[model samples]
Target: MQQTVVEHMDRVAEDVVALTLRATAGDLAPWDPGAHIDLSLPNWLDRQYSLCGDPAERDAYRVAVRYDPLSRGGSEYVHRFLRPGRALGVSLPRNHFPLVPAPRYLFLAGGIGITPLLPMMRAAAAAGAPATLVYVGPSPATMPFADDLLRSYGDRVRIVETGRHGRPDLHALAATLPADALVYCCGPATMLAAAEAAFPAERLHAERFQPVARTFGPDTAFEAVCARSGDTVTVPADESLLDALALSGRPLPAGCREGICGSCEITVLDGTPEHRDDIGAPEGRMFPCVSRAVSPRLVLDL
Candidate 1:
């Protein structure tokens, strides 16, 4: 973990604040679009926020967080208690969902999901790439950096404030996107699912802010072997392989633990890995963070 001191803090909206932090220890690592850093606050709570500033700025990192009333008060603490000059431990930036190169890009953001898209939009503009951003929020007042986004992107952006109207037309967005554009979405499960249904997987990228509740389908059971420890564990129908691994004191390297983040990705030595995540898919690997084994037996390079 690397320690960083908050250099500045600014409120962009009633419930949203932007934090600019400078590394207090070693040099910070480089990050790409859709990268996030795990922050360890003073109160022993861990929170992950996406990087929203220029990726080239390694020594200084910028993030915007929204306060969710339903959330366990992590955003509230960051907005209320965290201040400039305060020090906090931050993990190296990790990218679970990254922007894939394409002729054009279509970005869909819901509320706080806009945090990551801001930097991506800037990067796209800088690269002279064709991109369009659709940001949905409760209202103009509740939306973070609404004015900033408009001013920066001008006509290339679309803001759908649902507080006044009901909800934005997802069908319209699906139809309006360019044919050859690579679609990227980050939002609630419902929005992601809708996007997935609207746009078939020809070239769709998504990052889930919350994991969808999985109902185990009828599938054959599998035996998971921990390659390093050589410990074998049986995955029963009643439990997930991840849960079984945790029960055996073999904790997988996970961040969200909900399968949204790809932090717990492992190598697949044998057996078919039932890929269930929306993150990047490298060949012959599996994201244990949210994926399950489809085959009867599997071996993992833990």
Candidate 2:
């Protein structure tokens, strides 16, 4: 983790503040369009926020945070207590929603979900890629960078403030896109579900803040064997694999232990893993925080 100072704090929208952070000693880590950093605050609180600033600028980085009334405490603390010049610990940037090469692109951003997609839009335009961004918010006043998006991108950008009319029909929008256009979306559950039903699985890519409903078999006792050290730990049915590993003196780095963040991921050397993470991890990788092995004995790359 690197110590960073909040260089600037400006109100970008209603109940939203954009923070500019600079590393205390040197340059911050380089980041891509869809990358995010783990923000560690005082009072033993930590949360992940997307990087929304220019990727080339290493001296500083920016992140926009929305005050959530139903927050687990991170967003509330950030809006209520944090200020300019305060210190914050930031982890190296990590990207799970990377942009894949496509002939054409379509972006769907809803409310605060636009944070990561902002840079993506800019990057796509700069690369001369044919792209369009459909941005939706509660109202113009509640959206960050709405005016700039209109003035800067012209016809390529579409803003729909739901206060003036009904929400954007994601199903209808998906029907109008080119056949080969890759649809990248980040938004609320309703919007995501609409896109999922309208677009093919291979053509639609989405980033979810909350885990989708998934069904798995009953949790049972399983052995997590460390391939390198030859140490074995038995994970109980009721307990999480992350906690079991820590008790066995092999704690791994974790974020959002509910399986939303991909921080506690470990490679499966030999086992069938019951993948329960939100980020659809490919085969051979599993999140120990909320995932388990289907096989009785599992070997991990520890």
Candidate 3:
């Protein structure tokens, strides 16, 4: 964890504030686009926010927080109590959504989901790669960095205010994209579902702020064998594999216990996983947070 202080704060849009954080000691670590830092807030509230500033700036890291009335304390603490000069604990950047080099790029963002894509679009444009961004929100006022993005990208950026003109035909737009165009979407589940349906798996990339419905097959009791510790923990149908591991004295590093965060990922030494996590790691890696085993006994590197 890095000790930092809020260097600056500005309301980028309605209910959205951008924070510039500077390390208390040395310079902050470098981070690429699509990377996020886990914020350690008061009362043990930990939340992740995507890095939205220029990667070239190593002196500070910028993140935007939208006040969600439904927030589980992270955003509430940030918007209500945090101020410039306030000290904070932040984890080094971790990225599950990364920009891959491609001939062309199509970025689809919904609401605050635009945070991660901003830097990506800039890098693509800077490299002279054909890139276009379609940012959708309730209105220009509610969309963070909407004005700046429009002014900066001009014809390359398209704003679709859903309140004025319902959800745009993002599916149709993606359907017609050239074969070589890589589609990167960070948005609500509905928007992601549309993109997933339209683009091939190899050409489409996405990051989710929320977990999809965590539905799995009828879960049954299973044995989780820890490879390093040689511990066997039985996971009940009602409990998560991660909780089972922790209770049995073999806890693994974890966060976001919902599986969207990719924090509790463990290598599968044996057994087939039901593979219900959303981060989409290839076979043999499973997030014990919400994933389960298909076989009666599964082994993990732990």
Candidate 4:
């Protein structure tokens, strides 16, 4: 988990700042698209950032962190304080959101969500696969890696500077690509929800950088049985199944515990799982971090 910083460059836009860190990959684990690494800072605060560079480059890993206005010191530290060439400890790549192999790949990114999709787009292009990227942001000047993406991909990539125009038409998105293409999107909850509503489930893959806010309709309790440990735990109405598991001393490798990162995902052996995440193919598996059991008793593959 120990790594030394190799290169650090800050890409500053009007509204966002991205810090790109090249870390020593001696103990680095190879990662595919939608994979992320966890960083342990000096203050015991750990955060996850997606890999935005070539996955095959084993000598180093690249991650971009954005400065958010609503951030809770994590982004603040990265933007204002963190320096280049500093040795740090980082976890091996943990991937929950994986890129599906397809004939064509359609990528839709908004603002900071573009971090994860950048590497995927480059990889898809390098493979000579047909791919189109539609990036929407406040403006051309505010969009991160805008000129670089445009210069590289050219006409295949579209940029929607919403600050001047308006929201990119979702209808246009549905009409732009072929039906057989696989669509991947990452952005605000509203954008992802709209995409889910517009596209068929079979053709879409999404990752939520933010947590999915769930409104508990009423009080509900459920039981979870861990298949590996053969341990039984009760999920209280106030606590999520993941929190309960962690509280019981089960160390689950997780990122974005809001059910966005696929890190805490486990197979559902029994009982109906209330799917809360928008990652990959939702074939009824459970993400314990945000998902809960709709049935009375649930059996997990641990």
The top-ranked prediction according to TM-score is: 2
| TM-score head-to-head 3 vs 4, winner | 3
Ranking by TM-score: 2, 3, 1, 4
lDDT of 2 by residue, 1-302 (tens): 88899999989889999999998988988889999888888868778888999998998889999999998999998899998989999988988988887878999999888998899888888888899999898898998988888888999999898888778887787778899799899888988898898888899889888888878888999999999999999999998889999999998878788787787888999988888888878788989999888898789998
In model 2, where do residues sit more than 4 Å from their true spots?
A: none
Off by over 4 Å in 4: 2-6, 20-27, 212-217, 222-234, 266-275, 280-285, 294-302
Residue lDDT tens for model 3, 1-302: 89898999999999999999888988888888899888887668778889999999887899999999998888889999888888888888888999999999999999999999999999999999999999999999999998899889998999999999998786688668898999999988999988888778888899998888855679899998889888888999999898898898777767677778876678998998888877887778999888888899899996
The TM-score, computed over Cα atoms with residue i paired to residue i, of candidate 3 is 0.92
lDDT of 4 at 68: 81
lDDT tens digits by residue: candidate 1, 1-302: 78899998988877889999899975688899889988878777777899988888878899988888786757778977888999988888888777777778988888878888888888788878999888888787777888989998898888887777766676777787777888888877777888888886877788877766657667556799889989889887767777788888887655666666666677888888887775655777877656778787799886
Q: Give the residue spans of candidate 3 off by over 4 A.
A: none
| Clashes within 3 Å, all models in order | 0, 0, 0, 0
Predicted candidate 4 versus true structure: per-residue lDDT over 56-78, tens digit per residue? 87767777777788877677777
Point out the worst 10-residue segment of candidate 1 by lDDT: 253-262
Better of 1 and 2 by TM-score: 2
Candidate that beats the other on lDDT, 1 or 2, i.e. the better one: 2
**TM-score, per-candidate, Cα-based:** 0.84, 0.96, 0.92, 0.82
